[model samples]
Target: GEAAFAHKGGMHVNAVQKVVRSYEHIDPASIGNVRRVLMSDLAGRSNIVMKAQELGFKITSETPELKEILARIKQLEHEGYEFEAAEASLALVIRKILRHREPPFKIEGYHVSIRRDRAMTVCQASVKVKVDGVVEHTIAEGDGPVNALDQALRSALVKFYPQLKTVRLADYKVRILNSGAGTEARTRVLIESTDGKDDWGTVGVHDNIIEASLQALADSLEYRLMKK
Candidate 1:
């Protein structure tokens, strides 16, 4: 029902941002929904302004940072990041632009090792992170390198942010940006996470699948922490 009010194209989003009734026929709130302005390569300054406002930032087309944010969004989209389906990551980008959000923890380093045999394969990940000036290191094994990395990072962080214990990945998807590049193609990882109450999606892009997955996983957890 609310999907009817979802605006995507650069021009449409800009118009809707300026005057909601211009594109939307009815008041979205009347139906217990909101007009969503999706961010994409086609997004304009209006889309960025609407997004910032949705994230609780007072911004406008006149804001100087709006140009920088739009440029950064386009650059990242060119690099294979898709923000339309990853509003959580987009919100984080705005938070980064405002320099108002501080990470709950900082990853010091991480290492993932995989072993393959005729019988089976094993993946182990070791992660080190710092929270409030204290360091925590943990090792965990999982079904895959990405899973192992997520487990290891969560294990290291759960000590300080117990809320993370409830967060789990609901879905994971990876897309090769340039199939012609074959194995050398850049990858975009999209992760859907939930804490049994709310769900959010985050995106990452990199030439290394693992690195891209890590970026999305970090954004997923960071987005959850931002709620608190």
Candidate 2:
């Protein structure tokens, strides 16, 4: 007789044999359901291209632009960016590369400052952006450094890409990959953005948390525009 056991997570199983037999008829290598799990988490350009092709996206592994896109992903990852968690951003990048689309805006520089005055803390950010050879500088204040930076960046870019006004940051996350390195440890930043219709995630990595956040934020905006 098969004995039933209650699992820790409110799950119940009659026996391991039943579970094993259930999947026994399925080929491990050819299992469609587990294909995503079987894929490498640190997928490269080839993997991206393969995934895209599976979805009917017109791109070939042999394309020269594919190599360039992979190179760019590698360079960013070397600086601490992780794309596995932000596949949408990766897809946008591949699309832009394939279409040879121009970036909507170029960032020249940015400055963020946080100050505390007894009872109040203030955060400010200033950003410089170039669009069609014209440069714009804007400043904004927010509750935190990141928020301030986002506001400042948008203020500078809104005139050039008004579509940006429709986009909003839906979520943000940060993780330290190597806490043993303490303040110098690599930090990964993930940002989720939506423009009423679609949502996407972007990732960045850097020793500086703010820089990582900025990279993810920038990619999020770029992805939105490229998709549009």
Candidate 3:
């Protein structure tokens, strides 16, 4: 069903945009599906224009922000950030350019520690986040470092944005960008989040796995908050 109307390659997508029958055999709406043009490093400006329109923003070839958004996408892709499957991150980029809105919260500092005994292991995290100039310090314990960090971060922010209680991490994926670097290789994290009513994907890339995860995690909650 997905293969029926999902277009990715730049040329194919451009053609489909010009004429749907150029590549599609049936109208997507016939099956209650809509044509999707996936965004990636291979995307053209038309892809950005269409995607922004779908997100409730009008971005034409003449729009100054269109060029900046395209350049930003290309630059991020070069840094090991993939947007084809991370529309939530891509939407944030568009919003940053179009609206110039400030983020709801800022992370001031965070620390994670692991304790091991002969019988078991425990991971604890402490997070300091600033919301509207007031700092919230939170601590949490989880099964692993990432889990602990997630808990601590959310606990710190939830008080300011109560709507975040409904948001949860649905899935997580990690990819090493430079395998040859082995232990020092950069990592890219992709996070899927859902707030019961909607699901979205966000991505982050960094040399440190924990930092990468935090980047993706922060985007997930920020995206949810932006919706409100």
RMSD of each: 2.0, 8.7, 1.4
Give the TM-score (vs. native) of candidate 2: 0.75
**Candidate 2 residue pairs in clash (backbone atoms < 3 Å):** 80-205
Tens digit per residue, CA lDDT, model 3, 136-158: 99999998998999999999999
Q: TM-score winner between 1 and 3, please give it.
A: 3
Clashes of each: 0, 1, 0
Which lDDT tens digits does candidate 2 get at residues 142-174?
Answer: 989999998988888889889899888899999
- TM-score for candidate 3, please give it: 0.95
Model 1, 1-228: lDDT tens per residue? 758888878789877757878998888888899888888888887788877898777887788777788888999998889987798999888878777557888889889999997888999999999999999999999999999999999999899999999999999999999999999999999999999999999999999999899899999988999889
User: 1 or 2: which has the higher TM-score?
Assistant: 1
Those runs of model 3 whose alpha carbons end farther than 4 Å from true positions after fitting are none
lDDT order of candidates, top first: 3, 1, 2
TM-score each candidate.
0.91, 0.75, 0.95
Off by over 4 Å in 1: 1-3, 29-33
Model 2 Cα displacement at 157 (Å)?
0.9
Single out the weakest 10-residue window by summed lDDT for candidate 1: 95-104
Q: Give stretches of model 2 more than 4 Å off.
A: 1-46, 54-57, 71-79
